[model samples]
Target: NKQIIDATIDYTVAYKPNIAFYETQGSKGWDSLQKTIEYIPKECFTIADAKRGDIGNTSAMYARAFFENMSFDSITVAPYMGRDSVKPFLQFEGKWVILLAYTSNSGSNDFQKLKIDNTPLYEQVIATSSQWAGDDKLMYVVGATHPEEMANIRSLVPNNFLLVPGVGAQGGSLKEVSAAALTKDVGLLVNSSRGIIYASNDIDFAKEASQKAKEIQQEMMGYLDLLC
Candidate 1:
């Protein structure tokens, strides 16, 4: 874990620690996560990828736990409970709430793509949740695996950033996602957690990870030009 952090901190613009991974290990995992967050450079944005959403009051505490106590710049939220479940997170100034809209996993199709009033459930989630916060404070999770729908997703929330996973290890094409989703703000945060961090297992793991990050950064530069 330390090797992964040391290898990619320089090139990574942000780091997301999915809380479940730590929860499984009990106190030791929590300790490691705290150290990992501390070890990360202050300049990079941090996200607690805890897909949390509950009743209004409960949601508020979850927001505080990550944004205030843990000091994550943003967090991923499940919008299953509607506006109240998400509103508490928006209450914090300068912190972002990345709502899960369309995920990369296969099971995402089971619900997200279902149509309600002739529109996909995920579309409804995006359209409705966007009303709670502006682009600066709200973003959506759209998997890179669904690149074909990116243009449609972008059209719905033209100004908000999209936190895209599934790149690299998940076989998502950065080019396809960028071509379909880039906005004037270059509004996308494509993540490649396992792919880059676990690039190798030998003594050269860090070296390999660094090279992988460099490769992604170089690829990103080309797409970033679209923003110019």
Candidate 2:
């Protein structure tokens, strides 16, 4: 894990640790996660993929745990409970709230695509939650699996950042997503989990991971230049 962090310093812009994986190991896992966050380069953003949401008071404690205790730069949030569930995370200055809009999971179609007032719920989530904070403090989770919908999402919230997953092992095309979603801010944080970190299980794992991350970073550069 340390090797991967060291290897990715130059090739990636952020590191996200899915909290469930850590919580399973109890205190050891929590310790490892904290150390990992510390090891990450200051220039790169750190995200806690906790997907937490609840009533106002409970949500406030979660905000404190992640934003104040662990000190993550941003966190992934489930916006099902409306403004109260999400507002606590947005209260922290310089920290960000990445609301789940359209997830990449197979079951996402269950409700995220349901139409409300003639618009998809995911679209409404983006449109409404974006009003909570400016682009700097709020982002949306738009999975790469929905490349077809990328353009429309961009149209809805053009200025906000997007924490996109489903690339690499998930069969999401970075090239296609970039074409549909790239904004003036280059507003996409494309994530490749198993595809990069597990590129090889051998002793050369870190080397292979670095190579995979560099490949993605280099590809993103061309698209970024297009905006210039």
Candidate 3:
């Protein structure tokens, strides 16, 4: 992990460590997570990727655990429980709540794509959640696999950043996603997890990972240039 960080931090602006990977290992894993979080450069944004959201009290504890305990800049949250489940996370100043709206996995269609009064549930999640906080404190997860939905989502929350996964290994097109979602601010954080990190398993893994990340960044820059 340290080697990857050293090699790619130059091209990476954020690092999201999915908590499940660490917690499944118990205390030793937690220690490693803490060290990784601390090791990340202050200039880079860090996301817990915990996807936590529950009742008010439980939510508050989750918020404290990530925001205070871990010192992550933000955490992904499941907003299906409604405002109370998400509000606690918003209370912490300087922290961000990245609400799950449209996910890349097939199961997302079962709920997020369902219509609530003719509006897709994912759209409702964005429109309704926008009321909870401004773009500064809130962002949305819109999967790259669903690039067609990006324009609709941007219309709902034009100013909010979108954390897009499913690019690389998930067969999502970075070009399509950037075209649909990029605002003048370039308000998108496209994630490429296994594709880059697991690019190689041998001695040259870090170098290979760096090359993969560089290719993505260069493509992203081309899109950014178009916005100018």
Candidate 4:
């Protein structure tokens, strides 16, 4: 992990460590997670991909654990429990709540795409959640796999950033996602986890990971140029 960070920090803007991966290892894993978060450059965003959301008090503790304890810039949260479950996370200034809307996995279709009064549930999540906080304090997880829905999502929350995962290994196209969701502020945090991290497993892994990240960065540069 240290090697990867040293190699890719120049090219990467944010690092998201899915908490479940660390939790499985217990105390040692948590220690590593803390070190990794501290090691990342302060200018770069850190996302605790814990996907936590519960009742009010529980949610407050989760928020404190990530925002105060770990000092992460943001944390992904499951918003299915409604406003109270999400509101606690927002109370901390300079911290963000990344609400899960449309996930990249296939199972997302089972519930996120279901319609309520003819509006897709994911869309409803975006529309309603947008009212809860300004774009500065809120973001939505709209999978790169759903480019078409992404366009609609942008319309619903035109100013909010979208943490888009699934490009690369999951067969999502960077161009399609950027075209559909890029805002004037370039409000898209495109995540390529396995594609970059596991680019190689041998001695040259860090070098290989750096190259993979650079390729994605270059493509993103092109999109930003087009946006101009």
Q: Give residue 79's lDDT in candidate 2 (0 to 100).
A: 95
Clashing residue pair totals per candidate (backbone < 3 A): 0, 0, 0, 0
Tens digit per residue, CA lDDT, model 1, 1-228: 677778787778888898999999999988888888887878989999999999999999999888888788999999999899999999999999999999999899999999988999999999988888888899899999999999999999999999999999999999999999986665688899888878897889899999999899889878888678
lDDT tens per residue, model 2, 93-158: 999999999998889899999998899999999988988889989989999999999999999987
Q: Is candidate 2 or candidate 4 better by lDDT?
A: 4
Compared to the true structure, candidate 2 yields what TM-score? 0.97
Q: What is each predicted model's overall lDDT from 0 to 1?
A: 0.91, 0.92, 0.93, 0.93
Error of 3 at 225 (Å): 0.2
Q: Name the regions of candidate 2 deviating beyond 4 angstroms.
A: none
Residue 134 accuracy (lDDT) in model 4: 94
For candidate 1, the per-residue lDDT at 98 reads 95
In angstroms, what RMSD does candidate 3 have relative to the true structure? 0.7
TM-score for predicted model 3 compared with the true structure: 0.99
Worst 10 residues of 4 by lDDT: 178-187
- Stretches of candidate 4 exceeding 4 Å from the true structure: none
The residue pairs that clash in candidate 2, if any, are none
